[model samples]
Target: MAHQLDKSVPIPLYYQLKELILNDIKDGTLQVGDAIPVEKELSAIYGISRTTVRQAVAELVQEGWLYRVKSKGTFVKAPKIEQSFIQALGSFNDQIRDLGMTPRTEVLELEVIDVPGFVSDKLNIPLGSKVIYLHRRRFADNEPIVMVKTYLPYNKCKFVIERDFVKESLYPVLGESLETQIRKIRRYIEAVESEKYDFDYLNMEKGKAVQRFISIGFNYRDEPIEYSIARYRGDKNSFEIIITAT
Candidate 1:
C-alpha cells in the first residue's frame, strides 16, 4: 500500500490512513481479497498508534471496502460497479455485480391499481385503466440504496406480478412475457431533500440529499411500456455521461 501522509495536515491521522487504504484499493495497488498487514504491523511501519490504525480499518470495513475475518486479518474488498449513462441499455444487476456487491431487492408492495393521470400520460394509456404498481427497495450489500416505483399496463403484463421480482430484473421479464423490445428510454434526474416516507423505507435522515430519477421505457413499436420513478442516496451514487463528437 502506498500513501503520502502529511503530519502537518489538519486532517486526523486515522482519516489519513483510511484515505491511503481506500486509494490503494481504488488504484489497483491492492487487489480484492488481498490481506492487509495486522494493526500492530501497520502501526509499527507508520509510526502511529494501534488505535489510529484500528479506527481507519473499522471505518473501511463499515463502508464495504474491507472485510475482516476473526483471526484471519483484514482484506481489501471488491470495488463497486460503475454504470455508464452513455449507454441507455444497462442493467442494475450487472452494475451491482461490477461493483463487487450483492444486489438484493425486496418487493415491498405489488397490486393492480387505476392508472393516475400522470402515469397514464407517461405510459400512453387511458386514465383509470388497470396498471400494475410495483414498489420495491433495492439493496447493495445489505445497504438500502434505492426505492423504486414502477408501473406497467395490467392487461399486458399481469403474469409479471406473479414472478419473483426480488431476484429478477423487470426489463428481461417484460421482454420475455410481452415479446416487447426496449428500443429506447428517456431519463430525467434531479436533486431533492429526503422526505418522511423516504426516511422510513431507505433508513435515511430527513433533509438528506437524494437523487431522483424518472424513466420512460418504450418498445420497438414506439409505444410506452414502463414508467418508473426511483430515488438514490446522493452520498453513495454518482451518474456519468459520456459524450463523443462526430
Candidate 2:
C-alpha cells in the first residue's frame, strides 16, 4: 500500500513524498529497474502540485536513487557496488566475495612490451625497459565492474605474463614470485569521460563518466613494482574511505 501524505506534520510535502518513495523501495514495493510513477500520477495521488512532485523526484535523481529515461519514465536505479578495495589493500576477488558476490576475471591481453613513458614514470623504470603488460576486465556477479591495465618490470615479473590471471589474483602471485611483498600503494582518483576501451571492454557508452584509478605499488624494499590504471563505471561503482583515530 502507498503511504498517505500527512498534512498535519510540519515537514514539507515534497520531502514527505520523497520519503514515501524511498520507503516503498526499502519495503520491496519497488525494485531496481522498476519504473516509478510519472510526475502527474504522483502529484495526483499525493494531492500536491506537479512542481512539488518534480522537486522530490529531481532530488532523488541527483542523489543516484533514481534515473530518468528520455521518453520512457523514471526508474529505480540499482544500488552501486561498494568498492571495499579502496578502504584497504586486498585481493579483489576476496573482497567481492566477502560482499556475497561472485567475482570473475577475464584476461584480455598479456604481452612483454617496451615500457611507455607514462608507465616508466610511474614505475621509475627506464623508458626502453621491457615490462609485462597485462590487461583484464573484472566482473561481479556477471556484471562488468572494472577494466585494469597493469605494467610490471619484466626482469622481476616476467613469469606473470604466462600465469592465468583469470584464475588468480595478481597481488598474491607477485608476492610469491618476487623477493618482496607489496607493502604500499599510492593512488590518484579522477573522473574522466569514457573512451573507446571503456566502450569495448566495459560495455560503457561513449562519453559516459568513468572513475579512473591510477596507482603505483611499492614492494617491501620501497621499489616501485607495479603501475596500473583501472577504470570503473561511474554509475555502478562507489568508493568508501575509512579514517580512524590512531
Candidate 3:
C-alpha cells in the first residue's frame, strides 16, 4: 500500500494514518479481505512510532472496519449497514425480520419484584409496587447485539413474566394478554461507556462506547405502561431518525 503523509498539517500523526487507511478502503483502493500492513512496517513507512500505528489499527478493528486473524494478519471487513429508526414502530424481532436476518434473544433474568423509585415514577405507579423485571441479551444471527432491561406493571399482565421471553415479544404479550396497546412513546438517546455489568452481559470492553436509549411507552388510555433502558454497541450498531414538519 502507498500512502502520502503531510507532516506540516496540524492533525495528529496517528489520526492522519487512520484517515489514509480508511480512505483507501472506502475508495476501493483496498478491497475487502485485503491484508493490512504490519504495525512495524506501517510505522516505518509513516515515519511514526509503532505505538501510534498500533493505536490507529486498534481503533479500526474495534470499529469493525478490520479483523485480525490469530496467526495471520489483519484484513479489511465488510461495513455494517445502518438501521433507520424513522421507518416504523416494530419489535426487535420484527425489525430484524424486515432486514432478512434472524433475531434471537437470550433471557438473562426474568422476575417479579418491587418497583424501585425511578421505575415506579416512569411507569406512573406508586413506589414499591409490583413490577416484572425482564432482562435479555438480544442477538442478530447469533451475534450479540444489545442488552435490554424492561419494567412492566405486574398487576396489569399477571402471567407474562412467567412465559419464555426468549421465544416471544413483550409487545405482543402485552397487547394480547393485558389488552394494552402502545399508542405513543417517548425516547431519548445518549452516548455512554460500558460498565462492569455491561461487560458481563454484553461481552464488551469496560470503557467501550455504547448507545443508550431510554424509552417510556404509553397505552391507548394515555397511561404509562412500560419503561425500558437499552444499550447497544456503538461500533456494531447505529440508528437514524427522520423529522417531518407540520
Candidate 4:
C-alpha cells in the first residue's frame, strides 16, 4: 500500500513511514522472508524523499522487524519474540502465537521439591515449603528458543504435576484447571551467557548471549504462587517495553 506523505502530522515523516511498513508486517501484507520493496521504489511510490525512506528503513532494521542482506535488499524478518511488560500479563505460548509462530513445549521434568533460601524468599513462601517444579524446553518452528524452570506452591497447585504440560500450557492450567488466577506479575530481565541449561536443553552454541527473564506471579488474593526463570536465545528473540511518565 502506498500513500502520499502527510505534512500536517506532528510526527516526523520517516517515523510515519516506519509505522506504515510495520503495519504491513503486522497485517500480513509483508510475510516473513518476503522481500520489501527497495527504497527507490518506496520513495517513488510514496512521493517521499529517499533520505526519509532510508531513515524509516534503518529504524525498522534496528528494531528487528526487517533484515537487510548486502547486494540483495531488505526482507521481512520473522517477528521478534516480545514480552510487553507494560501490558502486564501474557502466556509464553500466546506471545509466540501473536508473532505467528508455532509454539511447542517439551517437558523435561516435573516434580515437587524444596528450593533454596533466596528462591523461597522471592516466591514469598517460607523455607522448606514444597514447590511443584516444572522444567520445559520451548521451541518456535522446531528451533529451540528458551528453557524454562517454573516453581509453584505445591499446596496450591499440586494438580499441575498430573497434567501434561506439553499439551496444556502452564499458565492456562494454573487458571482454568487449578483455580489459581494470576492477577499481577513482577518481572526482572538480565543478560547471561550459555550455561548448563543451554547445553542440556537449548541448541545454543558456547558463549552465545542469552536473555534471562525472571518473573514472580501473584494470584487474585495477592498471594505469590509462581516463580519462573526463562532463558531465551538472545539472537532469536527481542523484548520490548514501554515506559511513561508517572
**Ranking, TM-score, top scorer first:** 2, 3, 1, 4
Candidate 2 residue lDDT tens string, 1-246: 277999999999989999999888878899999999999999889899999999999999987889999999999988788876775779889988987899999998999999999888888888889999999999999999899999999988877777899999999999884453678888999999998988988898887899999988899888999899999999889998988999
* Model 4 CA deviation exceeding 4 Å by range: 1-79, 177-179
TM-score versus the correct structure, for each prediction: 0.70, 0.92, 0.72, 0.68
For model 1, how does the per-residue alpha-carbon lDDT over 68-146 read when each residue is reduced to its tens digit? 8898999987543345643657677777877778899999999989998889989888986999999999988888888
Give the root-mean-square deviation of each candidate in angstroms. Answer: 6.9, 1.8, 5.4, 4.8
Clashes of 4: 0
Top lDDT: which candidate number? 2
lDDT of 3 by residue, 1-246 (tens): 587778899988888899999999999999989999998889888899999899999999988899999989999997763666424557889887877889999998899999989898889899868998999999877878789999988888667867888889888777774346677778888998888877887778777888998888888887888899988887668787878899
lDDT (C-alpha) at residue 39 in model 4: 92
Note the residue pairs that clash in candidate 4.
none
Given candidate 2, what's the lDDT at residue 5? 94
- To one decimal, what is the Cα RMSD in angstroms of model 4 from the true structure? 4.8
Worst 10 residues of 1 by lDDT: 78-87
